[model samples]
Target chain A: MAINDNNTDSNKSQKQEEKDLPKVVIFLPPPVFSLIGEESFASNKFLFLKAYDSQLPLLQFLSTHSKSIKAILSSGGAAVNADILQLLPEVGLVVTTSAGLNQIDIPECRRRGIKIANAGNVYSDDVADLAVGLLIDVLRKVSASDRYVRQGFWATKGDYPLGSKLGGKRVGIVGLGNIGREVAKRLEAFGCFVSYNSRKKKPYVSYPFYQNVCELAANCDALIICCGLSDETHHMINKQVLSALGKEGVIVNVGRGPIIDEKEMLRCLVQGEIAGAGLDVFENEPDVPKEFFALDNVVLSPHRAVFTPESEKNLSQLVVGNLEAFLSNKPLLSEYVD
Target chain B: MAINDNNTDSNKSQKQEEKDLPKVVIFLPPPVFSLIGEESFASNKFLFLKAYDSQLPLLQFLSTHSKSIKAILSSGGAAVNADILQLLPEVGLVVTTSAGLNQIDIPECRRRGIKIANAGNVYSDDVADLAVGLLIDVLRKVSASDRYVRQGFWATKGDYPLGSKLGGKRVGIVGLGNIGREVAKRLEAFGCFVSYNSRKKKPYVSYPFYQNVCELAANCDALIICCGLSDETHHMINKQVLSALGKEGVIVNVGRGPIIDEKEMLRCLVQGEIAGAGLDVFENEPDVPKEFFALDNVVLSPHRAVFTPESEKNLSQLVVGNLEAFLSNKPLLSEYVD
Candidate 1:
């Protein structure tokens, strides 16, 4: 009877341990579309609250249940600023439902010994497709001509400058990652010969690999930025790179804005340093300089290269999957070393 | 000596005729990119003048040399409205660089007994490529998302939605002409099942032929508009047609704008009557309602689908060649019979 009682207690303890698993406080920084049908977290048992605001409120809420709060999931355009990271000292993990890790301070996470993982490569295909789309949009001047016809200017004495074709053009890819490779494959379909530059030549890739960006630019008709942003790559596309691209060449940036020298790019575009530019990202976003808006040759967007319904879902699945894997003690799919 | 004198006079008359050559008056509308380059018409002795702007000036100039105007070549997007046709009574022939005759009044030409020919099949490849590009852009949400990422909203919460892959999708092309045939071939490379709807079932076309638009839409996942704008095809994509396309279907219009009902289309989109639309032409252009301006579900462009540098130059060559053939009493490549 005593042995049976001990076995019963062991079973109960196992159930209790499963119920008491470290809580994951997912901070809902904003309302998701059709959230009414979404599943809610079980109360007092690994509770997940919807903040729909800043990390300060999240931190304030987490501080109240500090003992059970082992991890935090944050969302929205706002990044994990310094204030929130400093507040959550006991937090073991900070997960983001985004592919970019720029907003999350990796150095601070490293210093605090807290694990930081991002939903990287989830939107690679979506972004790559758009990069090619933007390039085509600019090269063909699709939007500009569309405006011309819609405005009844066809009846006037104006000319829609003939657009260049995409086929048989040399396309230089600055980065050879998932997005870059995808772009290469798609461009290849259109008869574009693709050449790329990366930190090192990838053995798995069969396309022509260049040792440097300038060499790639000099040989190609279009120089596309698909590389990541970092201190080393900050303003990498300076006057030198523009000169290498030449007057007949075009530059299309689908990567981070800091990777290009905005001031230099504008000067080059205005002075015909390069033929034209199709920019999706900017050095300072949502506040593009007045100079950029005035240019007709350049095709400028508000930096929304990966905003799609498919990409959104793909990224969410990756983030949620990573969280599930971490909780289950399986290795994270896209773990950030920092 | 008398025989020599007569031969000399005949030679002089021949030379005079060659020098005159009727001063073939050509009217080019707006948007003809290369404008029948220098060597193209100069060697043939055509006085090239654009009729897109200030038709009064062109009319006055043409009237002065009306007896010399044996032929007229119009290459631009400028419409040869009914008013323009009344002035061409003395003009022996009218040649257009584009295949579309919607802008030219065929009844007026028949009444005046003027021979008419147009450059056909020159822009089929160009138009087909743009149609598929629009389809991919809509299915993938290419432009909208590119707008989102470039705007620096990626660091924020949520993922873009997942898009349907084009591979294995059923594509119904509503014309088996040069453009539709080319589109089907391109879709084949993408692993898509191609079907077509034409006036008469094309015997040589390998793709399955659907006799009706409703039948084609019901069978296919996507529909492409590549037909001509005629009495039979006006408002072809009305509410009933779209209803047959199903709620998850996509429509890509590279054809004339009048074929689709703008009011009905907006209603269909608002009520989720169809999944999405990629329109290169609209029922009433340049005045795309404010409703379409903000939707990510639709992509709008001015009707410049047949635009490309190579195509423009090719079209010019075709126009010149058509003139040469007609002058030599040879059958035209693309003759319009009233």
Candidate 2:
């Protein structure tokens, strides 16, 4: 009789179901939850604790599962703020499926002595590959040429306009981090001279560093933004920098949206203030300026730089691996270091 | 009065005007003529002789001015055949702006002891750059993503499907010539391990060489056709090799059309027997199979791989340099050997 009542399931109290759950729960929110849904939607998916979408307030929910919540899985869109971190005393690890730790409160986690594991260099290759792809698309007109062919213009029109060359051109890389270095490596292979603008000069690196981004823009034929989005880097590629880049310069952004001033960039690209642009991210994502729709010089890619079937599968493994390492009291697979 | 008479020139004979021309004249044809017009169209453009577009037959034209026509400027769409070469016995040099010498009668020119100058490695970088561009465009879905963003589908239609990764991909190049080697160089920089199926194994190269194209297709994640169009290579990438490439394989063609079996490839791509293709050259370019227009996996590029502003400028210089060398009784800038 009791089994029959429980089997109906509408009678199963939320508190009772919560009580029956095991310890060491991993919390998932918006982006990570959806990503996990893509691959881990099949079976045994009950392992992930999804409390972010619950009826209770975030802090209240966190407080309720405070003891059992051993780790937090984070990614784009949702910020793992300090208050949320503070509520979970047992939360020893924060695993983000993103290579960039912009959404995570790094300072708060550092203060708490809670370890953070990120996607690390797993996404670096894919992101850098896209950056190079966009660069070639812009400089060599890959996307435009594709459009021309797809539209049956090749048969009707005489030729697509000539594109700029990659070789012998000066290319400036922003951030000079893992992704930037990867871009530099690939661009160098294409015979482009790679200089960079980082927060500070990296030691043992041969690329000429410019402290001021404007100076970097003025010197380079193309500027590829690979820096993470932070207050210091927000709108770092502004009107002044774009102007310095001049009419012959192209800019490729694989970094976050706000890293460049999209309004100014749009105007610059439309007016031919800059030669062209290859943009993956915009000021407001999924709402790329409609002005870019018809521009042949601009190659607009919806923020998909870090995505590839292989990379996402790799990321899932990495996310699971990081959480497993934390639970087993083993070293983190990809511990984030500032 | 005498200047006016010459300036009007109504009574001037064609032979009289031809008599005014120089003893040694370089020829101009369709593709080369148009390409030369792109760069050298300013003032002294009358230097290059015009004969290919004349009312006279090619042989009659060559025979009429055999001694005067010292050099032939060749390019795509026009063939420098045995009869034309035989008629112009005094044609001391043949300068082709194309790196591939397939259009020119090599054996006939060799027997006549006429030196040949071609665009050597000037186009290799641009062609290789485009090959890599198309490769990344296909594998990373660069062009498709661009379309998604451009069409406002990203905001409404949700995320674009994930693309295959370039990193750790086993890429097989059909030809290990200058462009193929350069493509290999660029792909290696992107973390793609490159192998090749050339006419024969290249000396001093470390990469694995596949004697059989089917074996190469079987082993690789992607295949890039860079071989010249000739008897041995025409339709070489047929059903068997494409089938060996499997369902997950991608192919890129920067070589001339007809190197791959176009109809079979269209079938493979439509049926998903092969993953996708990035085609810069189609069997009948400017008239690509209309079926390819609707395929998201296929990135159709209007055969602009060898044409970039900088590369074309470089080519013009090389063409002029080769012609100048021939006229001055000096060694050619890019003398063809075989």
Highest TM-score model number:
2
| TM-score (chain B only), all candidates | 0.84, 0.89
- Fnat across every predicted model, in order: 0.21, 0.90
Per-residue C-alpha lDDT of model 1 across residues B121-159, encoded as one tens digit per residue = 778877876787778777766555544543435446334
What number of clashing residue pairs does each candidate have, in the order they appear?
Answer: 31, 0
User: After best superposition, candidate 1 residue B235: deviation in angstroms?
Assistant: 2.6
Best by lDDT: 2
lDDT of each: 0.72, 0.83
lDDT of 2 by residue, A1-338 (tens): 45676666755675566555433433445353465464542222124566755787767877887877777877777788887888888778888878777888888988898899988888899999999889998998888988888888888977888787889999999999989999999999999999999998999999999999999999999999999988899999999999999999999999998999999998998899999999888888888878889899999888888887677777777777777777778899999876
lDDT per residue for candidate 1 within A189-303, as digits (tens), equals 6668999898889997888989878888889999889987867678888888888999888998988888999999889889987888888788876556667655656666655
What shift in Å separates residue B86 of candidate 2 from its native position after superposition? 2.6
- The worst-scoring run of ten residues by lDDT in candidate 1 chain A lies at A35-44
lDDT of 1 at A103: 67
In candidate 2, position B77 carries an lDDT of 65
